[model samples]
Target: MAASPTTGRGRPDSLDHMIRLTSLTRRYGRTTAVHDLTLTVRSGHVTGFLGPNGAGKSTTLRMILGLTAPTSGTVTVDGVRFRDRPRGLRHVGALLDAADVQGGRGAEAHLRALARSNGIPRSRVDATLREVGLAGVARRRVGGFSLGMRQRLGIAAALLGDPPVVLFDEPFNGLDPEGVRWVRGLFRELAGQGRTVFVSSHLMSEMEHCVDRLVVIGRGRLLADQSLAEFAATSGGSTVSVRTPQEGALTARLTAEGGVVRAEDDGTVTVTGLSAARVGDLAAAHRIPVHELVTRTPSLEQAFMALTATSVEHRAGEVAR
Candidate 1:
């Protein structure tokens, strides 16, 4: 599917590479996997999909790929349903599961099969392997490849058609540190080329660095969808860490002064609804000698946990070490 400049192959067309989900819902018997989801994933940005377990992420992705039917509502790629489009791979490339590939086939053979089915150029297969750093292992059977190698091969297949829209579920699962950095750069480069890139992963730190936008869901419902910065800013958890020998006294003093204090396992107290300066002042006024006082901005993981805390399907108890 080498896109001709005039026919708009490499870049998006008049619709500008948008995935629109309107009241998109899916149900299994009495259980609803997705509830009235409505959002637009636009081109030129890497959108991260996030949720706790059983948030209907896999079901939603399947519905978008036309592999599963929604109970109600609709999902459209570039203003048209995915199933309605002939040769859909040229419009949307996805990696739902890297392990779904045939293990008996060579890496090149697997990609060739995909290319043939999608009407993608046979020659593009080799080029994609080289692009994904799999050229050296093109003829290697997928069964012999490591998890990291399998991930690269799967990425190569997704880029085989050079589609305008791509979705990846946990693309960094088996990547090394170097591979992780490469994938992050790849997402940015694709977004720079005006493609709609939607990725779903539980790695909050990776998402913080990779995605420009975030779409968070919990309990089959939309929890947050906005720019990464905007979502982080909304966490509303500006906290100060206070470490002192008299932790109990300091915590009591901070709480008495209308501050929320959460004890840490490290013998420190995290003070909220107050500033570092106020925490220091309270410690001094209460005659508590402070060892450390530092303000901390909430990370993406912290923000995600805060939003999905109530929505977790099965909360695990702390394991004693």
Candidate 2:
């Protein structure tokens, strides 16, 4: 594994992986929030933790950070439990909730207090503020700031320790387009520095472009864990679109050869259950002149929907007429 560029002062030298969760499970009363989730978050990449509402994402994160005790199993950071670590913040930096900060204090003051408690220098607070673009309003009270500003302040506080493992939960909640773009770049930079960046979000479009690895869960159970490219490649199969002047003849030949064909709106035939190469060859054998033949791969959102269809916890009911 590559070394993290954002290594803090107290980073352990012997550690390899940033986080390891072994059979981690959590429950509340009669309900299970997380079910035997075993995952390893490696360094030098951005991993996206994805799930629908009530899919145990937040519960797992809380367990990893030692904010909530797991009913069973273990979560370790640098081969040590978070609660057992002498200075937990120095090993992992997390932004679980933007509203967790103290409302009465200014942004700078809040960060300074956290730094002081963690034995970090006060100067680091300002530096972090500037890094997250909150230095201009560092003196403004957090309660008076907008949601986006508060989110930035929370991120600044998380970076005060400059830990190798950084986690963000819905960091793009209130961010405008510019802020969202900045966060995307920031995650890439952090990962380039060889740091472990784990972010959780339901926004598949954003995750499609931002994350390298994906850990998808549904209803407290693991659904799929794979790279973005692998996930898309293994999602059933691709559709082949072919446009020919002899649409009727092509459709009949394609269907006869075990291809599911559907007439598209724009005078093209959409072929599934067959490969593009096979379709092209069949068209050639029948002497059908092909104007256009293209294979369309499933988008990230489409693949995710198909994989998690059975795992969705809540469904919008049909409205009353």
Q: Pick the candidate with the highest TM-score.
A: 2
The 10 consecutive residues of candidate 1 with the worst lDDT sum are 1-10
Estimate, for each residue in 133-174, the C-alpha lDDT of model 2 and write its tens digit: 887888888989888887888777777887788899999888
Compare the candidates by lDDT and give the number of the best one. 1
Summed backbone clashes in each candidate are: 0, 0
216: Cα error in model 1, Å: 0.9
What are the Cα lDDT values of the candidates? 0.87, 0.84
lDDT of 1 by residue, 217-274 (tens): 9989999999987887686467888889988788788889999999899988888899
Q: Positional deviation of 317 in candidate 2, in angstroms?
A: 1.1
- Cα-based lDDT at residue 197, candidate 1: 96
TM-score of 1: 0.83
The TM-score values for the models, in the order shown, are 0.83, 0.91
Q: Give the residue spans of candidate 1 off by over 4 A.
A: 1-15, 240-271, 274-295, 318-321
